[model samples]
Target: MSNQEENINLPLVHKGKVRNVYDFNGNYLIVASDRISAFDWVIPTLIPNKGKVLHKLSMFWFDFVKDIVPNHIITGNFEEFPAELKKYEYLRDRSMIVKKANRVDIECIIRGYLAGSGWKEYQKSKTVCGIKLPDGLQESSKLPQPIFTPSSKEENGKHDENISFEETVKRTGKDTAEKLQELSISLYKKVADYALTKGIILADTKLEFGFYDGHLILIDEIFTPDSSRFWEVEKYAQGVSQDSLDKQYVRDYLEKIKWDKSSPAPELPKDIVEKTLEKYTDAYEKLTGRKF
Candidate 1:
């Protein structure tokens, strides 16, 4: 519910595309609203409970993936949250109180399947992010294995440009880039495999990492629909676009409507919003094996 607004009462630190980060002394309180964005533009409407779905799902992963790498999450528990924020019951499940990290400026992406821009790139050049792929791979085709594909993290309203492994080294130094590459792929592989048990195909996901107390820790949201493509296992097919439990559905609707992805993005229809909510909630329940 925060754009670029700065109010003295809130001590807002940064407002990204969908998250409002408030500086809570040394720590930070990140609040995700029900804002749904597509084509890099926040649409005209909001989806009820969308933020909670994302927030809770991320909390589940922070704990689930901690053995791979430590994270920035302090707690999403209401009692453990800051005293000032505890008064609002709505924020209890939808807000995360996290430790501040020296934010990394890279998007650590890992792809286990051909989809989205990767599919488009492969169709024309038989490559993705400058990496050559085998011949005859179709859309949504599984990769030989998970590949690390890092991108330059862009500022709000700017598109992130995919960069090569060499470029990642140049931007963040060889040592840090290597860590990001190793950690991203390992986490993706582990989680992608685990997701299969939940009856979901983890096509790929984006992650952000940063230095916390001299240790590289995973930061930002991990494995949420907004960050990952969650395809239903039964609906997956090699040559066809798989049914997704993610924001891809919204993008599909937008594509069908032929809406120019400029400002004044069209408001999503009620059915579209309802379907998205169902997908989000379903993903949460299945992945966590807990009631949403």
Candidate 2:
């Protein structure tokens, strides 16, 4: 076997939001760091164990719902991780060992509520990514059923644009497009239903999929606060926007800034950083029913 054939800690190919993807022989070792990003730019501060919490939460869902669908999780145990990462075992729950697959070029989005780009698209065109909604739907109103809205996975610093299903088929092949849509909606509904029962309203989420061999598998994080909009069940109601358990506070702060929302992201204030960390911790405890 070549040196690269044996599991070795190599260089990283991509870093996004809270995770770092490093080359580990033929497989990849994805390390979940405590880093956070808002408005598509990575912020300055770390959120103590945020990566581990996110990883643990996703692992819980993967196990809870794997019977419903297959995923790409190779291993989450530190003992099985590459030797170079053993010192970071304190964050074992956040990192994952996964086969590096050819990631689908589209971002598979599922929306159960009208907000974010969905809301903005609806307000202007009375539709979101080519899916028209019923008239008179208020902000944050729940849809009768979840919808699969695909977006472009742009290069760094570029915004992901919501594309029609036909457009998705154009970018990815027709067969792959059909599979992604089916799998995305299936997983979203299963995970969302479970979260609802656990007092967390999974308003909406984004999932990325990839092809490993001939199988369609779920890649990246599932329904973590960073990837999904989570709300407290007791406070959620139709028509009214409730406080999100995720990084809404951080987003709100960023919105108030004068930056152009581009590269070289602004440094978040200490107080804002602290509050954001607390929010992540609170969501970890609330959704997982355990302390971080």
Considering every candidate listed, which one attains the maximal TM-score? 1
Local lDDT at 61 for model 1: 91
Residues 1-292 of candidate 1 have per-residue lDDT tens digits of: 5432232246878877677888887898888778888888888788888988899899889998899999998888777876677666667677888889998899999999999999999999999999999999999999998888888888867888999999999989999999999999999988998999999999999999989999999988899998999988888889988889999999999999999777578989999999999998999998989998
Give candidate 2 regions above 4 Å deviation: 1-9, 82-84, 88-91
Among residues 3 or more apart in sequence or in different chains, the pairs in candidate 2 whose N, CA or C atoms overlap within 3 Å are none
| Residue 11, candidate 2: alpha-carbon lDDT | 79
In order, candidate lDDTs are 0.88, 0.79
Question: Which regions in candidate 1 have their CA more than 4 angstroms from the true location?
Answer: 2-8
The prediction achieving the highest lDDT against the true structure is 1
Q: Lowest-lDDT window of 10 residues in candidate 1?
A: 1-10
* Clashes per model (N, Cα, C within 3 A): 0, 0
lDDT of 1: 0.88
